[model samples]
Target: MSRSHIRHELSKLESCLRKEIGELANKHQIKLESKQSSLCEIIEVLTQAKLCDEPLFCRLTKLDAAFCQLDIGLYGLCADCENEIEPERLAWDMLEQRCAECAENYEHQHRQELRLNH
Candidate 1:
C-alpha cells in the first residue's frame, strides 16, 4: 500500500477508536477536552523523546495514552507480543499492535521496551 493509504487507514482507525474512547470516558464522567489535552501532552512528550519511526503509531498511541491517563484502559500491552494486557482486558481491541509472546520476544526487544515505556 502507498504511504498515504497506510496513513489514511491509520487516521480513520484512530478516529474511530477515539470516538469509542470518548463515549466511554464521557459515560464515566470524563470531559472530552481533558482527554484531548492529555493526548496533546503525550504527543508532545513522545515527540521530545524521539521515538518510533511510524508517526501514525505515535499519534494513535497518544490517543490511547490519554485513555490510560484517565485510569481507564491503557493497559500495558506488548505491541509485538499480542499478550493480554494486565488490566481492562481489551481482548476485543482487534487493532492491538502486538501480541503477548511476540512482543516480549521480538528481535528489537530494546526498541520495544523503549516504545512501551514511552
Candidate 2:
C-alpha cells in the first residue's frame, strides 16, 4: 500500500524475472548446441525459444521502465487516466501501472490503432 512497499515488491519481481530470463537463455543455448537433434529440429527449437523469450524480454523492459518511473515518484498511477492503480492489481503484478478500466480502454484503443495501421 505504501510507496516503499511497492518498490520492494517491484524489486523482488525484477529479480525473479531476471533469474527466469537467464534460465530460459541457458536452455535455449543448450538446445542450440545439442548435436542429437537434426538441423530442422534445432531450427524449430530455436524458433520456439525466441518466441518464448521475446515476451519475457518485453516484460523485463517494462519492469525496468516502471522502476525508473517509481524512482521519479510516478509509480502506482495509471498512465492513461492519471489515477491511482488499484492496490490489488499492483499486488498481482507490480509492473502494471494502469487501473482496470483505463487499462481496458487503452487496450481497445491500441487494437483500433493497430487495425488502422494495418
Candidate 3:
C-alpha cells in the first residue's frame, strides 16, 4: 500500500483506540473526583500503564509513534533481518515489525542464556 494509504489506516486506528479508551474510562468511572481516591489513582495509573492502554492519550501517543515509522517507510520491515514482514502476518497485526521466525529464534536463544545462569 501507498504511504498515504498507510497513514489513513493509522488515523482510523488511532480514532478507534481513542473511542475505546473513552468507553473504558467511562465504564470504570474514572472521574477527577470520586467517592474513593482509588478511582482517581487508577486513572492516573492508566496514564502510565505500558501493557494496558486504558488512557486515551497514552494509547494515541504509542500509536502515533508507530504511524510515524509507517510514514517513514520503515513499518512492517524487520529490524533484525531487514526483511519485509509477511503480508499475511501484517494483516493480523500491522504493528508487528519483526517476522515470526526471527522472533522465535531470538526468544529461543534468549531462553538458553537464562538457563545457563542457573
Candidate number achieving the greatest lDDT relative to the actual structure: 2
Which scores higher on TM-score, 1 or 2?
2
Clashing pairs in 1: 79-98, 80-103, 81-99, 81-100, 81-103, 82-98, 82-99, 82-100, 83-99, 83-100
Task: Give residue 28's error in model 2 in angstroms.
Answer: 3.9
Q: How many backbone clashes does candidate 2 have?
A: 0
lDDT of each: 0.49, 0.70, 0.63
Ranking by TM-score: 2, 3, 1
Model 3 lDDT, full chain set:
0.63
Pick by TM-score: which candidate is best? 2
Candidate 1, residue 76: lDDT: 42
What tens digits encode model 3's per-residue C-alpha lDDT throughout 1-118? 7777777877788667655655665676654332333323434545654325334555455465567677677887876797987888778766565688887888999899999998
Can you write out model 2's per-residue Cα lDDT over 1-118, one digit (the tens) per residue?
Answer: 6778877887777667656655665866643433344324433554566653477666665676687778898888888788899989977877886899999998999899999999
Clashes found in each candidate (C-alpha, N, C closer than 3 A): 10, 0, 0
